[model samples]
Target: MFELLGIPPQVLFGQLLLGLINGAFYATLSLGLALIFGLLNIINFTHGAQYMMGAFVAYLLLNLLGIGYWPSLFLAPILVGLVGIVLEKTMLSRLYKLDHLYGLLLTFGLALLIEGAFRQMYGVSGLPYPIPDVLKGGQNLGFMFLPNYRAWVVVASLLICFATWFLIERTKLGSYLRAATENPALVQAFGINVPRMITLTYGFGVALAGFAGVLAAPIYSVNPLMGSNLIVVVFAVVVIGGMGSILGAILTGFGLGLVEGLTKVFYPEASNTVIFIIMAIVLVLKPAGLFGRAR
Candidate 1:
């Protein structure tokens, strides 16, 4: 068998698998950001904070309330989503009529506030989340061993990305939401509650971030700054995939992850900046992004 980029097949495949796992996260996170920007027209800087909150929320529920991963998986997102809803209603909603920069700044401050509060409480230490028993094994895949939990993460992320795409592209409620995104006044004139829809949309977008956080809790350490650096990469993925299309966001996320993984095998030094380099290339070649339609 030809070694991939002169690396051993085993090492190559392992990194690729890990890359796909990280890509799963990128897909989910970027998808949430894309949904928020695509519909709300707001660059949500608080997204990373919200993702961190979801992981922290699960940790707290597990330690303080005796809740486990299974329950927290659903509860954490809903709880964080409520927090998002409150933000939209009280602050984000007020910025809809203003320039997009205002919303971005507001969310940037909000991210700082959230991360600071959590860092103060948790002290920047990583908390471990126990994996559920049902998802705790591994399968031998000849070349690489596949952990059940990581596999679940990829599958779950894909299911979510697909389901969201379906809902947005094929559903009646999605039609209304898209219409509201395009023109709230016209949507409201048609008897739809556009403001409420916006609130729910923001909530839902952050909820997806929360869901990714929950899935990530078991694999990565749950920490206040967990999403800090990760968010930058996710933003790059969004730019490459294009905020104009959720499917584009999802595809770019996973694709870049694989690319990153491959790069790690051949040129370890470039692992960190590969995605951004790709983003720069995309910006130069296609400002609208891979899947984004030209404005």
Candidate 2:
């Protein structure tokens, strides 16, 4: 097999696969974050906790109620999304008129409360989420073995990302959403229910996180701390990709994941900080991010 820069093709491809998988999660989570930020102007720090909640919800459904993976995949996001709606109605809505920092502080507090509660109840250990039987095996791709579940994750995430982008960018509903985001008063004057839109947008963003959680559950241990760690890297990803662009977030996420994966194969030590380093470079070179527009 051919080698590049002292790395074999197999190893490179394997890391690339891993990177793509990570990028899927990054893309999904960041897109959710970007949507919330773009529309609500709120930095949702609790996004990771909501993702953790999605995994826990799936676990609960399976272990407690005997629900299978397929059902939980759909149900988990809906449940978590409803919770988001409730939070927006009860707590988040109050801060809409306040300084943006208040929104951040409130969400940060919510994240801590959530993570702390789950840790107290479940401890730090992770629980296993079995992959569906149909996706149990791998395919030999000449130089490497590709797990069915991982492949599914990449494909499914891409589909969802593009679908979301289309809905927000191309559709009439998306036009209303953009209009509301830009001028809620004027949109309301035009007969749109701005508050309902905000609530649903938050719910939808939370749902995206839930979807990611279900996908991640089979790959990583379903732990309370899972979202906490992943959120930081995702934040870096959002920063690098730019907050204003949905497609940018999607592209940056997958591209960074590939870069990170290759780094792991060639220099494992740098893999951890590679994202932050990239964020820093992007900041120095383009303060608004690779695809972000200046505010």
Candidate 3:
């Protein structure tokens, strides 16, 4: 077999594919964070917990209700999103005029509370979610084998990310949303319900997180702390991408995921820390991030 960098092509390509898969999840989750922070100005520490909730909800639907994965993908996000809307109306909205730290602290507390509640019930053991029957196989691309479900994840995540970007950047409704974010008072003066728009935007962002959770369920073990494990890395991706920059978040998430994957192949020990190291470098050189604009 031909080799690159003295590594087998299979190993090299396999790791690259694995990197892309991880990138899909990172992109999806970070995109949600960017949306919430950019439009709502909320740090949203509870996002990880919301992600955990999506997986749990899907698990419950499948085992308890026999709903299966296909339906759970859509249903889980909607259900979790409704909960997010309630959180915005009942609690998050009040902090809009306050310091960003306040929103961060509140969401952080909520994350702990939610995680604690799930851990109490589910314990720390992870649960398996079987891949759907239709997506159970793999394809050999000569150099590497690609699992069907993993391919689906990459395609689905990229499509959703693009759709979200287009919605926010190239549509009429998106213009309204951007307008409200920039100057809510003026938007409201023109007869738009700014508060409601903000609430829905938050819900949509939470839904994106929930959607990512469903995609992750079959790939990773489902557990209360599942989100806890990945959220930090995702936050790093958001920071490196420039928080609140949609395009930046999408591109950066995938880019870092590939970087992490390759690091694992070349230097196993550094793979875990590579993303953070890049983050630190980005911070020192450009505090605003690679894609973020300084205010």
Q: How many residue pairs clash in each candidate at the backbone level? A: 0, 0, 0
The CA lDDT at 108 in model 1 is 95
Local distance difference test, per candidate? Answer: 0.90, 0.95, 0.91
Candidate 1 per-residue C-alpha lDDT over 112-164 given as tens digits, one digit per residue, 9 for 90 to 100: 99999998988888999999999999999887888999999999999999999
> What ranking emerges by lDDT with the best candidate at the front?
2, 3, 1
Clashing pairs for predicted structure model 3, backbone only = none
**Model 2 CA lDDT for position 54:** 93
TM-score of 3: 0.98
TM-score: model 1 vs. ground truth:
0.97
lDDT, candidate 3, 39-131, per-residue tens: 788778888899999999999999999999999999999999999999999999999898888999999999999999999999999998999
Ranked by lDDT, the better of candidates 1 and 2 is 2
Q: Which stretches of candidate 1 lie over 4 Å from their true place?
A: none
Model 2, range 1-295, lDDT digits (tens) per residue? 6778888888889999999999999999999999999889988999999999999999989999999899999999999999999999999999999899999999999999999999999999999999999999999999888999999999999999999999999999999998887889999999989999999999999999999999899999999999999999999999999998889999999999999998899889999999999999999999999999887
Better of 2 and 3 by lDDT: 2
